[model samples]
Target: MSAPSPAPVSTLAPWPYPRWIAHRGAGKLAPENTLAAFRLGAQHGYRMFECDAKLSADGVPFLMHDATLDRTTNAAQVLSTTASNTGGDHPWSALAQLDAGSWHSRTHAGEPLPTLENMARYCIANGFFLNIEIKPTPGAEEKTGQVVGEHAARLWQGQAVLPLFSSFQPEALAGARATAPHIPRALLLDTLRNGWLDLARQLGCVAIVCNHALWDAALVAQVHGAGLRALSYTVNDDWAAQRLIHLETDGIITDRVDFFSPATP
Candidate 1:
């Protein structure tokens, strides 16, 4: 009799492989948060995508990296082009028309900013997971979190494809917890400050996403001790990636999805 085929591999946790993630969709390849960028990442074999989200004035959750539209879009120029587009600050009507992708490349010209709904639809339809960073504009933290959480709840309702919502704003995370209790949330830290674990626990975070440099073996173990997953950001090299793996980190967010040589496929 023919030998039985080897048992199927288990894709279980500490997860199935090393935690290499793509930052801002595929890094600087395609415009960040645009559908094109996500599609490009899939072509490169990425199963997870990360992007920033904030609320428009009308309370629509939309993808954007900056607090203002000046950097990634032609908002300022568009305002200059028409008197009607001019507003005191952050006028939603004017902000909506700015071509968010043109600044990245002429080829991506006229690509409009995408809504959270749009992004959710795309990710779910494509069998991809997401990391939605709740980036509130200055002084909009509580509202931004509540609105985005509600939107995320409605979008991912009754589906298994819930996005991992994250933010540096602790209050935002708390608000998200109140608004969408079912969605998983991560605590984002740019610095390794005292009392961070207290804050993370208070917010009910499932993971702590830090700037990789902020973590060493000790910190990774401490996080795990608290029953929290440890995730690092912007890790783009083999040595750094290996170090994190050795430290037993839960995930690594990287700009170079192309070079992430994980131990397993």
Candidate 2:
């Protein structure tokens, strides 16, 4: 006997992303979600990056983690006091004029917020992988996911490693599935809720990105048992990284790009 055919070798979905992912581009090294940040991450030998994507008021998909620009951009000074503070309420043209880097540091004072198209071009040309988090505004989750999914599919055409889409919203993932079923997706959870695996299966996700604190060896095994990859986010410490490594996690999204050394397999 061949030992029962080695228990049939349960097959998992194909995982195209690298194990080490730079969070929000360079992870606080440069302005997050800007071309400069992506470039910085690459300079640090990072081949994979994670950034947030959302839709502008005019329906253009752009890179922005927050619903409002006031935190990352000079929106308070650029937009009229009466203007809506939400990033989704502004057109890309208006968004383009706001300084997205000054808030971080004076060294990057003039760096502009980059569109998803611009970021995609940069990443594709440089042979980098991307994890696009669909961070939609309230009530706009479905449309934002649809538009971002469509744009991502178009942008990454002919590329070997396709962008992986992830979101905390099931509605957003559902919309993405409707728009571009070919693109791989992941479900992001801050906490492991009841029936989370079922929900991930329903959304057709190839992976589940969880809060770093949530994963252990058993959980990782469970995720693998479900034929899905396990990934953890915002892992900024050595202990966390070591734990994930010990647990055989599939991916680690980190803010410590410089510290972690992406060259590590």
RMSD of each: 6.7, 1.6
Error of 1 at 237 (Å): 2.0
For model 1, state the Cα shift of residue 59 in Å.
Answer: 0.8
Give one digit per residue, the lDDT tens place, for model 2 in 5-28.
556576686677789999999998
- Cα lDDT listed for each candidate: 0.80, 0.91
Please give, for residues 1-265, the per-residue lDDT of candidate 1 as tens digits: 9999998653322333236567888888888888878877777888788899887766778888777666788876777653432122454666668797889999899988888888899888887788999998778888888998999999889886588989999888888988998888899999977899999888888789999888897898788878788899989777887788888788888778667743333
10 residues in a row with least lDDT, candidate 2:
1-10
Instruction: Tell me the TM-score of model 2.
Output: 0.96
TM-score per prediction, in order, is 0.87, 0.96
* Overall local distance difference test of candidate 1: 0.80
Clashing pairs in 1: none
Clashes in predicted model 2: 0
